[model samples]
Target: MALRPNPTLRQRRVGTELRRMREQAGLGGNQLARELGIHAAQVTQMETGKSGISVERLRTIAAACLCGNQPLIDALADMVSERGKGWWEKYRGTLSTDFLEIAELEANAHSISTWATTYVPGLQQTEDYAAAMFSRFTPSPPSHDLDARTSFRMQRKEAVRHGKTPYASFIHEAALRMQFGGPRVLADQLNHLVDDSLAGRISVRVVPFDLDTFPGGGENIMFIEGPVPELATLQMDTAMGSMYFDAQPSLTRHRDVFARLNSVALSEPESREFIRSIEYEMRGKYA
Candidate 1:
């Protein structure tokens, strides 16, 4: 069978670690290829997630790259053997590359933390809210494309709902009150959030608008905690595309930001009450 056109997040993450190791080893693609006794193109394919590497070969490459830690080597070997399909795979070719990548990362995350100042996080959005947001995209997407986006988004929500792992989200009060799809959609979304929050699949905390001091006040970010040896963080800038970071310092900075934001957000019960207030206000108009 022909190889799949799209790569899963785990594969891409593995590829990223390999590329980083090669760079850190002061070896270029050609040099690494020489060390591995493989063609440079083959090395490039593996590093770009277009192809897989065998465990034995991966170990050999790690040794060549001076990655001697046994745990790190073992992790790389495991990554090489990962062949499970991620939920994002079904949406391949339908959504934009950036969006698809985000979905994959979200699916693979051991834990997720998001700071949203203008809109609810994708994983927490209800179907109607998602549709309204999609409808606002510039030039507007075709009906079919919009439907595909909605379906893809709903699938993403399902991953969080059913996964063994959990997700944590910090939403600015502005996002909760943004009214993306008018009162009706906003009401439903808020109610859905309340349900999800109470269910324990997601942790929803609201940052009151009056808070004068807050981390990530000016930026919206999604931080995903990847498995070890491939430890990484992916940041999405609304205007600027997505950027992937694996450097320890950078990941620490984001983690710190999330911690600070979490510290300032309302407690779980308080957040539910805050959301309930918004829903009640919306009901007055839409109910």
Candidate 2:
């Protein structure tokens, strides 16, 4: 069968995990090919996501690589079993690949934890708030592009809501207070946040400005937990673009960062009260 010219991020991730297993077993690509009775080039193709692997083939490779982690093995096999294109595929050519990747990651995530210092987490932003923020792009996007992005974001939010993924968001006070569209927009956005939190659909915690000795220096982090811990992905949003990290050490570091943030941030109930207070404050000011 012909190979895909550009595989989705999820497809590439399966290939990456296979490569890691091969390396951990101390077997080179040629050795792996020989063990599986395949050409070295074929092995490379599989590892680069240029080709697909069947569940049986994946099992054979995992066994040969001496990978004993049943959960990890099962996860890889499941990836191989996935069929058809996801909703994000429709925007393949229209949107940035990174944006589509984010949607795919969220769709497959077992749980999601985010840390936002400047802006409300994308999944939690209201339509008007998001539209206003997107309008600030340098050189500005064409109207259609802006509409597409905002529509895509709303779809992402719906996916998150219906997926029932456990979502924990650690937001700094500065972000909650930022009036991207104005006091009215911020008020509505905060009220929507309160409703989501009250309904037990999402967890929202706030890091107040009054706290001393805060770490992390205004970083935006989104940690996506896969079926297995080993398959977890960490995404850092920056001005340039989104950066993903999956190395054990990198995952460990971000986990620790989140833990520390959790420790200092307001508890869930307290966070709810805090948001309500802010919403009240905003309404009064705007009124």
Candidate 3:
């Protein structure tokens, strides 16, 4: 098969796992290709997600390599078995691949845990709030592009809405205080957050500002649990762009960070009350 120029993150991750397997088996790309009776370039293609691999092929490779991690093998086989594009596919050309990758990440997640400092997590933001935040982008996007971005964000909520996926969010008090779309919009958004929390739709934990220390240096971090522990990934937003890490070390570090963050965040009931208090404060001033 010809090389694929732009495989999605998930695809690339598949290749990553395959490469890991080869390395674990103590086989170089050329060596594995020889063992599998294929060209070294094909092995490279599979490892880079430039070419697709079937579940059978995956199992074959695993068997050839004497992989004993059946759980991980099964998990990866199941991933390649997935047949269709998710809702995010429709926005392929209109938005950056990062946006689509995030949606895909959430859609397939067994659970989501995130720390938000500058703004509400995208999965929890109201349409108006999202639009307001996006509107402030430098060299503003065209009005139509703005609408597309906002709609894409709102649609991304399906992954968490209706309790489809378990979501745990650690939001800073400062983010809750920002008036993204003016006080009225923010009040409504706060009300929505409170309602969502109380209704058992998702878990909200507030990280109060009084805390002496902050985690992740106030950067946004999203840790998505995959089908199996081996597949979990950590995503961070930086000045460069969205970056995803699935290496064991990165996942382990973020998992520890989130645990510490959770340790300081308010309990569920406390968080709801805290959110409601802000809602009331915003309402009292601007309602």
lDDT of 2 by residue, 46-152 (tens): 99898999999999999999999999999999999998888988988899988999999999999999999999999999999999889887988999999999999
Global Cα RMSD, each model: 2.5, 1.4, 1.4
The 10 consecutive residues of candidate 3 with the worst lDDT sum are: 157-166
Name the better of 1 and 2 by TM-score.
Answer: 2
lDDT of 3 by residue, 1-287 (tens): 66789988888999999999989989899888888899998999999999999999999999888899999999999988888888888899999988999988988899999899988888889999999988987888999899999999888885569547888889999999999988888999998888778878688899988888787766788999998999999988876779899999888888888889888889989998988898888888865
lDDT of 1 by residue, 1-287 (tens): 23436766567767888888889899999999998888898887888787877898888888899976677678767767877666676666777777778877776677888888888988889999999998987889999999998888888888778887668889889899988989999999999989988998789899998888678536668888766624757576566566666677877877888889877889999999999999999989965
Indicate the residue-level lDDT of 82 in model 2: 96
| Most accurate candidate by lDDT | 2
Instruction: Write down the worst ten-residue block by lDDT for model 2.
Output: 212-221
Ranking by lDDT: 2, 3, 1
C-alpha TM-scores of all predictions: 0.89, 0.96, 0.96
What does the lDDT come to for candidate 3? Answer: 0.89
The local lDDT score (0 to 100) that residue 170 gets in candidate 3 is: 91
